[model samples]
Target: MENKSEEKGITRRGFFQRILVGFGLIISAGATGAIASQLLKSLMPSGWFGEPYVYRKVYAAPITEINQVGASIIFEDKANNRKAILINNGGNIQAFSLVCTHLGCQVFWEKERGKFLCPCHTAVFAADGSVESGPPEKSLDQYPVEIKDGLVYISFREPTWQPEQYFRGEGL
Candidate 1:
């Protein structure tokens, strides 16, 4: 009888120890999660950082030789998944973003219509980057092109919302 009583006590103690260990593990895991969440929140940038400004050499072709009047040659940014167009309007070289401002669809130049056409919807932009038809209320984003040493250069930055007649706005 004495041996049986001692055995029961030992089992009860072991059971209690296992329960405590499980509860401790649960609490530790919860704490780890809370700490990780706090750390991630702290590391995130406050508000939106200004769009990254970048300058890239687009093509080596001569500006005067390429006579793509209504057609545009597309250049892709693999890092941000954006496309730009280099248009040769007569002898002048201009670059416009292929991304439609309304719904983010890629626009293609239509030679017959002499405009930039979006296939997803019938959005059209005029020869000088103005949105003439469709849902796009703003003009096509333009990049300043500089030609030097027979190489074409284009400057691009992250899309920013600018107020009317304002170079630097509160949103940017």
Candidate 2:
């Protein structure tokens, strides 16, 4: 047989080996770029990718409204058609929706009774928004609260967090 390497110069084995090296370098560069992109995303501010935030921090009320130790500031999220309460319960601040768990009626704070009273069905909730008695099977829905820039903010969770809502067309 003829010696192909000594004549043709480009050996098949060497060509394949060089092609494999090029492929490996390309893959390595792609992987490195992917990792660097993810790292840069981590350093960027939230929602910088032009996506909606997981939870929108809506301005609820002014911090000055929460003055007394036992005072509560009621606020409405007009865009959402929902109402909530921001209470300074002896310095332990908290907030939750006023919607009744049973039939979606509005609940009111009865400070005299130190509990929430649902007028539609007389369902009673404890001071901490837990179901104390009546027709409701669950407690009131609580939300995350934040204090910044001399204002109080309530975090309204996006519907995308619950996948089931999309199937039911509720998230639409």
Clashing pairs in 1: none
Q: How close is every model to the real structure, measured as TM-score? A: 0.56, 0.57
lDDT digits (tens) for residues 19-121 of candidate 1: 9999999999999999997887667534245444555445534655445565456777674444677888876888888878888888888767768888877
Best by TM-score: 2
| Whole-model lDDT, model 1 | 0.72
Quote model 1's TM-score: 0.56
| Displacement of the residue 55 alpha carbon in candidate 2, Å | 2.2
Runs of candidate 2 exceeding 4 Å displacement: 1-54, 158-172
Q: State how far residue 24 of model 1 sits from its true place (Å).
A: 27
lDDT at 77 for candidate 1? 61
Model 1 worst lDDT window (10 residues): 159-168
Please, what is the whole-model Cα lDDT of each candidate in the order they appear?
Answer: 0.72, 0.81
Model 2 clash pairs are: none
